[model samples]
Target: MSAEKIQIFDTTLRDGEQVPGCKLNKKQKLEIAAKLDDLGVDVIEAGFPISSPGDFDAVNAISKLVKNATVCGLTRANKKDIEAAARALEYAVKPRIHTGIGTSDSHIIHKFNSNKEAIIERAVEAVAYAKSFVDDVEFYAEDAGRTDNAYLAKVCEEVIKAGATVLNIPDTTGYCLPYEYGNKIKYLKDNVPGIENVIISCHNHNDLGLATANAVAGAINGARQIECTINGIGERAGNTALEEIVMVFKQHKELNLYTDIDTRMLTELSQFTSETMGMIVQPNKAIVGSNAFAHSSGIHQDGVIKNRETYEIIDPAEVGVNESSIILTARSGRSALAYRLKNIGFEVTKNELDVLYEQFLEVADAKKEVVKEDLERLMYQFNQTVETKFA
Candidate 1:
C-alpha cells in the first residue's frame, strides 16, 4: 500500500509568536513564511488577523508572499473575527479561514458563560460564514481534548454539515494522554456523520510534553493533518514541535505515514526561527538541538565510532548537520580518542595511545571538553617526552 501523506500545518508565525519575548515583526514573519513554503509545509497559519492592526498587516502581506502553501488566518467563532481573517487572506492563492469556539464544558461554562447547545450553534454558524469567503474553512473545537467524546462528535458533525472542509481537534491545554487523544480521534471517525468527507486535524500543545506523542497517536487513529510550530514555541508550555512530528513519521516507516517537508532543511530552518524569534533552541532538544548527535559517554562514543546506527537512530546529515560529533569529555573512550586523533593527522600505536590516554584524562578532568588545541598540546608534550627518553 502507498504511504499516507500527512499534511504539515505549520503555525510557527501564528501560534509560535505567542511566546513571551518571541514575537516577530512583519518582515520576520514574511521571511519565516517564505522559508516554510520552501520547506514544503501544507499550511502556514500566518496570524490572528483580528488581534491587532499589525497582525492583520502581517497576515495580509504573507498571503501575497506565499507561493505554494495555504496561507491561513485565525479567528474566533464570530463574524468580526471571521471577516478580519477573510480580508487578510484576500491575495492568497490557497487561503484558509480557521474559526471556531470552545467546546469543553469548562470553557463553555467559565470562558464563554454559555451552554453546549449554544456553543454548537456558534461553531456551525462560524463555519458557514467562513465557507462564504473561502472554499477551505477549518473549524477548531477548542479544548476538545477535555471535551466529552459524545458532545465533541456532535459539534464536529454540526460543523461539517455547515460546510467545514477540515475539523481541528485541539488539545488546547496539552492535557490529554496519547491513548486518550488517539481514542478521541477514533471516536469521531467512528461516530461523527460526514467526518470522512472532511479532513481531521490534530492541534496539540506540550504542557505535559506529550504533544508529539498525542499527534502521532491521533494520526495512527485517523487524523490526516498535524498542526504544529517550529521549535514548539507557543502559549505556555508551547505547541508540538514541527521537526519532532516530521521525524517521527520518517523514522517509523511501519506507520506508512510521510510528509512533504524536506528533512534536510530542518536544522537550517530551526536556527533561522530561533534567531528570528529570539527564542533559543535548547541544546538537548530533539532533531535540531546542538547535542542531538553528539556522543560523550565512553560506551556510546565507542559504539558510534564503529557504526552510527549503534548510537544514533538519525543521521546528522539527514537533518542537514555535517556529521556526528564524538564529543571528547571525561567519559569518552580510547576508540573515540583515536577517531579524533586520526581526523587531526595523528597515528599512534596501542602503547602510544595508552600513554596518551592518561594525559588526555588529566586534561579532560580539568575542562568541560577536550578541543583540538588541547589534543595538539598534549600530543606535542608526548613527542617531547619521547625525544627526551630516546636522547
Candidate 2:
C-alpha cells in the first residue's frame, strides 16, 4: 500500500526564535529558510510580520528566497496583523497567512477577556480576512489542547466554511497527554462538519516532553500536517522538535505515514538551527544529538558492533552523521575494548586479551577514559611482560 504523506510545516523561524537570546537577523533567517526549503518542508512559517520591523523584513526576505515550500507569515485575529502578514508575504510563490486566536476557556477568560462566542466569531473573521490576501490560510486555535472539543469543532467548521485550507490544533501550553491530544484531533475529524475539506494540523509544545508523542498520536488519529520547529526551540519548553517527528514516522512504518523531508539533512539542519539561533541542542536529543548514535555500555557496544540494528533503530548516516560510536570508559567491557583495539590496528589472541583485560582495568581505574595511545602503551608493556616470562 502507498504510504500516506504527512505535510511538515516548519515553524522554526516563527516559534523557535522565541527563545529570549536566540533571535536571528534577516540574513540569518533567509539562510535558514533556504535550507528548510531544501530539507523538503511543505511550509515555512517565516515570522510574525506584525511583531517587529526586523521580523517583517525577515519574513519578506524569506518569502522571496524560499521556492519549493510555501512561505507563511503569522498574525493574530486582527485586521492590522492580517494586513501586515499579507504585505510581508507578497513575494512568495506560495504564500500562506496563518492567523488565529485562543479557544480554551483559560485563554478566553484570563488572556483575551472574551467569551466563547466572541472567540469563535474572531476565528471565522480571521480566516475570512486572511483568505482575502492569500488562497492558502492556516487557522491555529492558540491553546486548543485544553479547549472544549465541541466548541473547537464548531470553530473549525466555521473557519473551514470561511476558506481555511488548514486547521491548526496547537497544544500551546504543552499540557495534553498523547491520548488526550489524539482524541482531540479525532474528535474534530469525527464531529466537525465539512472537516474533511481542510487539512488538520498539529502544533505541539514540549513543556511536558510529550510534544513529539502527541504530534505522532495526532497523525495516527488523522492529522496530516505537523507544525514543528528545529531542536524544538520556542517559548517556555519549546514546540515539537522537527527531527523527532520526522524520524518517528521514518522509523515506525507500521503507521503507514511518510513525509517529504530529506532524512539525511536532519542533523545538518538541526545543527544549523542551533548555531544560527545561538541555542544549544541537548546531548541526548532524539535524532540529532551528539549521543544519539554513541554507545558506552558494554552490552550496547557489543550489540552495535555485531549489528547496528541490535542497538540502533535509526542509522547515524540516515540523519547525516558519519557513523556510530563505541565510547570507552571504566564502564566498558572486554567486547568494547576488543572492538576499539581492532579499530586501532591491534588484534590480540584470546589468551593475550585475557592478560590485557586485567592490565586494562588497572589503567581504566586510574583514568576516566582510555584512548588509542593508552592502548598502545598498554600493549607494549604487555609484550615486555610476555617476553620476560618466557626468559
Candidate 3:
C-alpha cells in the first residue's frame, strides 16, 4: 500500500551454516552476528537452538550481543523447539521466534503424511505459541513455493490473526520461477486478511540460479522482506545474497524499495562469511564475486576504459569493490594495452603500439596475466625502437 521498504532478514547463521563443513562455533557465530549488526541487517536468524547444544549457546550469545538487529531463533512445530528458541532469545533487545511446518502436498505425503487441516492447525498454534513467549513471531510455510495458493493464503491469514509480525514463504528447494514466486506473494497480499500490517518475506535458494532475481521480483510486487545470506552460501546453492539484492534495489531506482543494509561494508562482510563458512564464492557470482566488475576481453576492456557505463551499470565502488580490471592477455587488443599504459602516465603513439603488440604476445606466452609491473619488466628487457610512440 505505502512505498515499499524491503527488510533484510539474514539467515546466514541458520541456513548458511547448514552447508556441509560450514559449522561455526559460538565465538565464530558471535563474530559473524556482530558483523551483521554493523552491516545493518533488520533481523538476524541467529540459529536453530534445539538442533544442538552448541547451536543453543551460539543463538543465546548472539541474542545477547546483537543490540540493533532483531535476534531470531528458529523452531519446529513442537514445544521443545519453541521453548528452546524462546530461551535462547531471552537476552535479545528485540527478540523474535521463527517457527514453521511443511504445508505442500509433497512434503505432507512424504515428510508428515498429514492433511491440510492439521497443517493449518499446527501453523496457527506455532505462531500463537511463539507469540506467547515473545511479541514478535514469524511463521514460515516450508516448501511454500509448491503449496496450494488458496491454502497458503488461508494459512497466512490464520497466522497473521495469531499475531505473526512476518510471514515467510520459502522456495526451499529453489524450484519456483520469478513469475510463480511473485504471484505467490501477490496472492497472499490480495487474499490474506490483515496481510498489509505484516511483512511478506521471501526466502529463495539458488539451485536454479534465480534466487536474487526471485527476491527482487518479490520486492517489486509487494513482499517487503528478503531472507538472505552473505556470499549466497547456504544448504544447496545458498539463499538470495544480501549484497546482490541490495545492489539490485540500488541499481533499479524505479523499484524504490530500500533496506537498512550498509552498502559499503558489503565486500568485507562477503569475504568474512565466505572464509568463515569455508565456501569460496564463484568469481562470476553477482555483487560480491571477484569478477563481478572484471573485464578481460579486449572490446569490453576498451568500452570500460572509455566509459564505465558502456559495460557497467553500477559503479564498482558502490559495492565496496575497488575498480574494473583490464586484464592483458593474448586476446587483449593493442587499444587496451595502450589505454592501460596511458593510465600509468606512459605516452605511446599508434605506431609504437604495433611494436608493443608483438611484445605483448610474447609476454602473454609466458605469463598467465600481464600485470602492469610485468609490462614494465618487458619494456626494460626489449629496449627496442617503437614503430610510433608506444609506452
Candidate 4:
C-alpha cells in the first residue's frame, strides 16, 4: 500500500448498532459485512464480541464470510475480553484484535478509578495479550482527545513496543477541535518511540459535529487510518461518517492522499445500513441524503439545468444515487418554469411563458411544491384569462 493511502476502518456493525432502538440480527450483520468488504473498507470491526452472545456469533460468522477485508473484534483491556475476541475471529482470513483502555485523567479518575501508570500497564498487557492471538493488534487509547499528550504518547509507545500494529487515538467524548486533534496526532509522531512502524488510526465522534473534519486533520498531520461508520450513526451524536471521509479524500486529491474505497458503493452502503438498522437518514444529510443532489431554489435549479457542475461538486451518479432533481417551488426561476412546462408537453413562446410565470408563482407559494396536475390547471386558467382579455 502507498504511504499516502488512508485505511478505512468501518465500525458500523459495532458502534452504529449502539444507537438506541437500532439493532441488527446476525444474518443482517453478515449481509452488511459482505457489502462493506465489497465496498473496499480496509477493516471491519465486526462487534464487541465479549459484550453479548449475539455479538460473538455475528463476529464469528462475519469472520468466516468476508473474503477481502480484515475482520476485527473489539475488546476491553482484560484477559476475558481479549480471549473472546480472539476466539470470535478464529475463522477470519485476516483477523485483527482491537483492544484498549481509558487513558484520560477523567476516565482514569472516574471511569476506571486508576492512575496513569496502571492505565499504561493495562494498555501494554492488553496489546501483548491480543497480539498473542492475532498478528494484527489494534490498541485504542479511549478518550485520548482529552488525555495529556505526554501520557497518551507514553501509553502508545508502550503498546507499540508490546506488539500493537495499529494505535487508535479516539476522540471518545468528541471534545477536540480539528487543530487540537491534529496536534495530538503530530505529537505522537514526534514523541512516541517506534511510532512510524505502526498505523496511527483516528477514531473521532461527532458530539461537536466536527468528527469528519478532525479525522481529516489527523490524516493531514500523521494518522493513516480513519475509523468511521455509515450515516455517521452511533451513540449520542455519532461517529465520523464513513461516506463523508471517503468522499472528502476522493474529491480532494490535491492532498495526495487516497483510500481503497470504491466511491460508487457509498450510497448503496448507506441505504442498506439505514434500512437494516431502522434509522431514517435525514434528507439534508451529507453524501447519501435525499436532498444531497436535489435543487429547489430558482438560481440553483437554473444552474443545475444548464450545467450540473455549477451546483454539484460530486456527481450524484458517482455515489449510486439518481441524477440531480430540478424541483419547482415558489422560488423557481422562469428558466426552470419553462423547462418543466416543456417536459410536460407544452412548448410556450417567451411571451406566453411570461404570462404564465406570474400565475405559477402564486400557486407555488401556496404549496410546498407545484405538481404537474397543478401546473396543467394553471396553464388552462391562463389561456382562459387571455381569451377573456381579447374577447
Candidate 3 lDDT: 0.88
Per-residue lDDT, model 1, residue 126, is 91
By lDDT, the best candidate is 1
Best candidate according to TM-score: 1
TM-score of every model?
A: 0.99, 0.97, 0.95, 0.95
| Number of clashing residue pairs, candidate 4 | 0
Off by over 4 Å in 4: 1-3, 379-391
Which parts of model 1 are misplaced by more than 4 Å?
Answer: none
Per-residue lDDT tens digits for candidate 3, residues 146-182, read: 9999988999988998899999999999999999999
Error of 3 at 343 (Å): 4.6
Model 2 — TM-score against the truth? 0.97
lDDT of 1 by residue, 1-391 (tens): 7899999999989889988898889999999999999999999999999999999999999999999999999999999999999999999999999999999999999999999999999998899999999999999999999999999999999999999999999999999999999999999999999999999999999999999999999999999999999888889999999999999999999999999999999999999999999999999999999999999999999999888999899988889999999899999999889999999999999999998999999999999999999999999999999999999
Evaluate model 1: give its TM-score.
Answer: 0.99
Better of 3 and 4 by lDDT: 4
| 1-391 per-residue lDDT for model 4 (tens digits) | 3438999999999999999988899999989999999999999999999999999999999999999999999999999999999999999999999999998889999998888888888998889888889999999999999999999989988998999999999999899999999999999999999999999999999999999999999999989999999999998999999999999998998888999988888888888888899999999999999899988999999898899999899999889977887788989999998888888998899998888998898899899998899989988898898899999
Clashing pairs in 4: none
The lDDT of model 1 is 0.95
